[model samples]
Target: MAWAAWLVLWALWALRGWSCLRCDPGSMQLLQELTGPYLSRQLRGDPGLRERLEALLQRSIEGLAELPIGLPSYMGVIDEKTMGEAAAHFRRAVTRIMENDYKDGQLFNEMMWSLQALRESFTSLMARFQREVFCPNKCGHMVHQFIDCRACRTEIYSCNRGLYCGERRLQVQEDDDLILDCALSWHRASYGAKSYRFYRARGNSEEVMVTSPDAFLLKKEVTANDSGRYRCEMLNTKGWVCSELRFQVTVTPLPGNSTPLPMPPLLGPLTLPPSSHPTPLGGPGDWTVWIIIGSSAGLVLLLIGGCAWLFRRQREVPKEDQDSPGGQLNT
Candidate 1:
C-alpha cells in the first residue's frame, strides 16, 4: 500500500511538470518559414551575406528551441498592449538594418510581414485559451510557470477581480544590466510598488537591489561584463504575488569595425578636374561694358535722326521757292 501511494505521488508530480512545460512546435515552424524566405532573398546578392544570415537564423532557431515552452505560451497569451510592446522589439530590429541597400529593402518588408503574422497568431492562441480557462467570477490568475532561475522566463496573466491587472516579464541581453520594462498598466490601485532582486551565480552571490519600485526612471547602461541570470519579485500591501519572472543575461563584447579600407589613390580610377569653361557672359565688368555700349548706340541713333530732319527741311525750302518762282535769279 505504501509503495502504491509513492508511485501515485510521483506520477502526479510528473504530470504537473509536463503541464507546466508549454512547448508548442507551431511557433518554431512559423518563425522558420517566415525568416527562411527573407534570408534566401538576401543570399542572392552576396554569398557572404547569405552565409551570415544562415548562421544568424540557425542561432536564433536554436536559442528559441532551448527556451522554455512557457516563454512562447506566455507570449501567446499577452494582451493587445503587451503585444504592442513585443511589436516594438521587432520594429527596433528592423530599424537596425541600413536603408537604400538591397538587403535593407528585402529585410524591412519581410520583417514587417513576419511581425504582423506573429501578432495575429498570438491573438488567436490567446483567444482560444481564454475561452477554455477564463471565468468571469473566478479570481484566479494564470501565469507562465518558470522552471529555472538562471535563465530567461516570461509570464502572462489576467485578473479575475477585474479591479487590478497587468503582465510583467524580464528579458536578459548579452550585456551588462538587466532590462525591465512594463508593458501594461491599469488603475492606480494596480500601480503599487514593485522590485527586482538580483543574485550571483557563484558561492556567496550576495543579493543586490537591482531595481526599486517607484515612479522614477530606471535606466541601466549595458556593458560587456554584466552577464548573469536575474529574477524579479513584485510586491504590494495587498498580498504576495504568485508569479516569478526570471531571465539569463549574457555579455558579449562589441564587434569591431570590419569595413574595408578605401583603395589607394593610384589603384582607383583617376578623377579629372571639374570643367572650368568660360561662361557666355564674362562677369560683373562685362555688364558695365554692355551698359556703356547700349548708351552709345542710343546716342548715335538720336544724332542720325537729327541730321535727317535738317536735310528734309533744307530740301523742302528749295522746293517751295522753285514753286513760287520768286527766287530764280538768286538761286
Candidate 2:
C-alpha cells in the first residue's frame, strides 16, 4: 500500500513537468530561448564560462522552481555522450561569434538590453511558478508579495499596485504611530505607460493595494504592531517592474523618565601657574618681601632708642652731679 502511494506521488510530481515554483511556463520558455543557446556554447570551449553560466542558470532555476538541483548534480544525471553533443554545439556558436569581431561598445549595449529583458522575464516566471506551487486552485486569486525588513527580520506584504514603493527603512516607538513614505521613479528610456501596486505583510497577515497616479507618493501610518515588510510593483504596457528597495519597519521601546544629560563646558588651552615661573633672587616680588623685613627692623631700632632715653631720665645720678659742681663754684 505504501509503495502504491509513493508511486502515485511520484507520478503527480512528474505530471507537473518539473516547472519552477515561482515562474510561469511562458516566461521560462522565453528564458530558455534567449539564454540556452549561449549558455550551451559557453559550456563547450571555455570551462570557466561554462561554470559561470551553469551557476547563473542554477540560481535562476532555484529562484523560480525552488528545486534542489545543482549544476554538478544535474550533470551527473546526463549521459556523457549527450553532454559531448551539447558542448560541441555551444563551441561552434562561440567560434562564430568570436570570428564576427563584434565591436565592444555595441556588444556591451546589446548584453545590457538582453540582461534587462531576462530579469523581467524571470520575475514573471517566478511569480507564476509560485502561484502554481502554492495555490493551485486559486491561480487567479491575489497573492501578497513579501518584502523582508532588513532591520527587524519581519516579512511584510502589500498589494500589487499600492503606494509604498522604494522605502528603505521605517521606525516607530511603542504605543506611538509611525508613518511610512515611499516614492518611485522609472528609467527615462522606459517608453511604456506604467502602473504600480504596493504590498505590506506583518506576521501572518498581508495587505495589497493599487497605487495612485504616476509620480505620486504613498503615506501609511500604523502602530508598532504594524511593523513589517513593505514593497511596491510597477506595471506598464511593456510588462512589470519591481522596486529593488526593501523597507524594514522596526518598533522601539519608549524611554523612561530621565533628565537630559548636560554637555560639558568646553575648555580652552591650559595656563601655566604663576608660582611655576622661576623667580629671580632679587626680583620685584623678592624686593617687596625684603622691604617688609627692613621696615620691621627699623621699627625695632626706634623702639630700643626710646626705651634707653626713658631709662636715663628715670636715673638720679645726673641731678647729684649738677648740684655738687654749683656748690664748689660758689665757695
- For candidate 2, what is the lDDT? 0.45
Q: Please write out the lDDT profile of model 2 over residues 1-331, one tens digit for every residue.
A: 2332332333234312222221233434544543466545533445564455445554544443333444322211222233233334333433444444343344334444433443444344344434432222211112232322112122323223332233578677767655444333322223335555566775687577556435333444445566678665555454445333456878776679347887555797766556877778888988899999999999999999999998997796777777885656643
**Compared to the true structure, candidate 2 yields what TM-score?**
0.23
Query: Model 1, which residues run further than 4 Å from truth?
Result: 1-178, 182-206, 214-219, 257-331
TM-score of candidate 1 to 2 decimals: 0.23
* TM-score, every prediction: 0.23, 0.23
Could you tell me which 10 consecutive residues in candidate 1 have the lowest summed lDDT?
A: 13-22
Segments of candidate 2 deviating more than 4 angstroms: 1-167, 173-189, 202-205, 214-217, 242-244, 253-331
Q: Per-residue lDDT of 1-331 in model 1, one digit per residue for the tens?
A: 2332332333233222122122323333443543466546654656565565455544443443332444324322333343344344434443443232444445445444544554454455545444533222232232332222113244433354432233333444444354554222221224334433433444446464454554222437666555555444444444455233444556555457257887658777888765586446677668889999999999999999999999999889967887786656763
List clashing residue pairs in candidate 1.
174-250
